[model samples]
Target: MDSFVNFFKKIPNKFASSAKELGKVQGIAIIAMLLALRVVLGMFANIGLAFNPYVKIGFTFLPMALVAYYFGPVCSMITACLGDVLSYVFAPAGASFTPGITAGYIIEACLLGIILYKEKISLPRTIICEVLVTLIGSLAINTYFIYMFYGLTYLQLLGLRAATLIPWAIIEGILVAVVVKALNRVPAISKNLPTT
Candidate 1:
């Protein structure tokens, strides 16, 4: 129980530390480059399901995961929100701005940070983290946002969106594990990455 309480206590401290990164030039530059990568991936690298306009499979999660792993939750949240806004601005996609969707992205990034920051990058951990993020951030949060926007029943939205969750989680988990492991092989990036 004390351990659980301590874990909760650490969260705010982590967030504070991450928030402070915004003031650093190196942090800002890294985040800016990652944010740009996120926007490009979101705009050009996603595939919309033919049956559901709301369902998109994208690589934006890569940058979000990287930011979370590097800087922790607050910075990840900020990057996610900015990336979402910028993606929308650059490519309107015939939809008005939706804060709810951006909120989902924030939640996604926060979850990733909480799960991955300062932790060993392993396949099982990455898989579990991706699953949880998809379940909470994408399925639960974003589904509701889509329901609100498109006037679809919440259950319908969930049904449609859930179809991609497992596959996405597995594929992304493998990709994240492979990518981080590969990056760890590079001396420059490995120095920046948290040691396992």
Candidate 2:
């Protein structure tokens, strides 16, 4: 029993010593998975629900910010922005101005990436930060660019109602928190992130 406990205690410190660290690879894989998920989800949403065009399932930035939370903003921010660009090229969901919305998406991702890059990755902190990012980002920061580029009012563009959108935002936050938690159980995945 003593030996078993000792061995388990030593496990984490083994991977915590590397300079490049674990989150880099984990960041790579997670970003790739996010891109793939976005593409597949977009395709399904397009086919399955005609009227659900503007409805977004945004787990991308949450994970990106998580990566940034450990890996630094520049690395994770680029990881995120590139993921969005790739998603657009691969999926092509909207007919609106690509450059503009892409810019907004990247901006939004980077902002949270900047903020959470300094914080812990626990659920309570993360969910609140995530919702704040979406509200300030999606509603305030990007609203004007979205309106100008897409030629729709703020309400029309995002389908923004505090009631409707908050639920979705909360759902996205929970989904990201749960998915990251599950990913942490996989040694290969958790092995890549920075130290606790």
- The whole-model lDDT of each prediction reads 0.86, 0.57
Residue 25's lDDT within candidate 2 is: 68
Off by over 4 Å in 2: 1-53, 61-66, 149-152, 155-163
Clash pairs detected, candidate 2:
22-192, 22-193, 23-192, 23-193
Model 2: ten consecutive residues of lowest lDDT: 13-22
Q: After superposition, how far is residue 147 of candidate 1 from its true place, in Å?
A: 1.1
Task: List TM-score per model, in order.
Answer: 0.90, 0.65
Runs of candidate 1 with Cα error greater than 4 angstroms are 1-9, 192-196
RMSD of each: 2.1, 9.0
Report the C-alpha lDDT of model 1 over 48-148, residue by residue, as the tens digit.
88876778888999999988987889889999999999999999765689899899989999999887877778999899999999999999998887787
Residue 35 C-alpha lDDT in model 2: 52
- State the weakest 10-residue window (summed lDDT) of model 1: 187-196
- The alpha-carbon deviation from the true structure for residue 75 of candidate 1, after best TM-score superposition, in angstroms, is 0.6
Clashing pairs in 1: none
